[model samples]
Target: MEVEADEEAALLSRPRARHIKKRALKNKALSVSFDEKDLKDFVGGFHKRKKKRRKEAELLVQEAQRRKRIEARKKRKLERESVYGGAVPATDSGSDECGEDDEQDEGSELVTSISGTATYDNGDMKVTVTTSEISREEDKFPSEKMQAAGTQINWRS
Candidate 1:
């Protein structure tokens, strides 16, 4: 027991080494001690890489926005086509077709141009296009209601 106490006293009397914490380099990161010139070079390189990465990210964002706009336009076009029963409307001149051409024109013809007007009131100009089916020649241009409202409708030749 005296020998054990002596050993314990010796152990306790010994000067202890201070605990020093060692810093580990993070994953994929380098810890470097450099002179002033080397630090300037490192900082310049880091800034250049940061700028390049930022530019690339911006380009990717712009490309995604462009793709979204194009997709939206395509979707709108598809929706319009579906709403029109899969056939797009066609433009029509003032010329009339024979009854024999009705069958041939059914698949192609959609809405014919009935009338259009451009009104300029106090520098505020507005243009309006009116479209309708022109199956019969006897069909009036302005219709009875428009004519009754004193509207001057002109039929294009």
Candidate 2:
């Protein structure tokens, strides 16, 4: 009798439960629509942001170029000092080691003289010359020793 009463009490205290179904709305039915002008405005804003980014990139590039020039000039100064063992003298005239002057004449003077001249009558003529010299001794390859050196050679096609 006590067990039956405990079972009845447990059944009375149990909470009731129910299943609920949620219906999903169609994407096309629920989607918000925008006009052409709205889309154009959004694109325009994106382009403006892109332009600002490009300007910032250009500024970065300019700064990098300036730094590179400064570094190159400093390196050149260091190299000059290292080569000269000290700072260059202020009175030292800047000139090339192979002192080439721009104003110096570089051409040979052409001399003309009235030499003898011959009159020619039109006639076809051809001349050919060939020469040969023979050597007393000729150098030959040391094939016997080269073969004795135990070198392997492979030829394939």
Candidate 3:
């Protein structure tokens, strides 16, 4: 009798499912839509889209390189301006460090030209080489210019 009463109490304590109201205004159906052509292209045109993106990225990189080259050129111009005391130096202008005048530099080219001729010998199968060099100022050498200029001509510069 106690077991039967316990079973009856347990059944009474269990909760039962309740039915939902069918006339709920907030619970409504959704109307979904999609473009079939766009969906198909998105799924199938992977390589085409990737190629276009790669080309755009390449153009961006090229533009960046061009900008970098321009900036570097500007920096070099600034450096040249600093070296030349805010003036753009001419090709033949004299330098202060060496103090070489263009007139003196033109005069100091002692060996103006050097030419050679090769004569082929048939009997002995030998070639005779004859070379001649022309000097502009053999008497007035660099020694005289060095004495007046007080510095050696830095041809390497």
Candidate 4:
């Protein structure tokens, strides 16, 4: 029909929006570029790159924590200095002593000295050790105590 032809002509005559979109896409496509080395690295070194990034982030976090701790210690030292010259002597000095924290962690690095014997039997070293009854109790002496761990007895004394 002539009306349908007129409608088709009107539709075709209108400046198309798809042409603008296509022109924009063509401009962007012309500008886009990819480096071969970078593309290969990204495609092949996924795990290694990820691990390196993680390590770098971890080191950054550790450094931040260390700096924070050092600052806190310095602040505490300044406060102590302002308090009193006659204050109780600290276990350690305020200056960076081996860059360590002041808190006493006895578990990590404390050594102890002991005098004589660490254990005293008090003349009653009664050790009743039954290791699977290696031999029947009847076969062993009644007054004897088993010294399987090489516990020295005063036989020569």
Tell me the whole-model lDDT of each prediction, alpha carbons only.
0.56, 0.53, 0.59, 0.58
The parts of candidate 3 lying over 4 Å away from their true place are: 1-40, 92-157
Q: Write the per-residue lDDT of candidate 1 for residues 1-157, one digit (tens) a residue.
A: 9999999999899877855445542344666876999888988999999999999999999999767655654564466465455655465321122223333433443333454445434444443344443333324455764664344433332
Ranking by TM-score: 2, 4, 1, 3
Candidate that would win on TM-score: 2
TM-score attained by model 1: 0.34
Model 1, position 147, has a per-residue lDDT of 65
**Candidate 2, after superposition: displacement of residue 132 in Å?**
52
Q: Write the residue-wise lDDT of candidate 3 on 66-132 in tens digits.
A: 6765565556556656555466656734342343332343333223345666666677465555455
**CA error at residue 123 for candidate 3, angstroms:** 63
Worst 10 residues of 1 by lDDT: 92-101
Which residues of candidate 1, in runs, are more than 4 Å off? 1-37, 91-157
Residue-wise C-alpha lDDT for candidate 2, range 1-157, written one tens digit per residue:
9999999999888866754445433333466887999899988999899999999999999999767655654554455555444656455454323334312312323233333433333355332222222122211345654573334232222
Residue pairs that clash (backbone atoms under 3 angstroms), model 4 = none
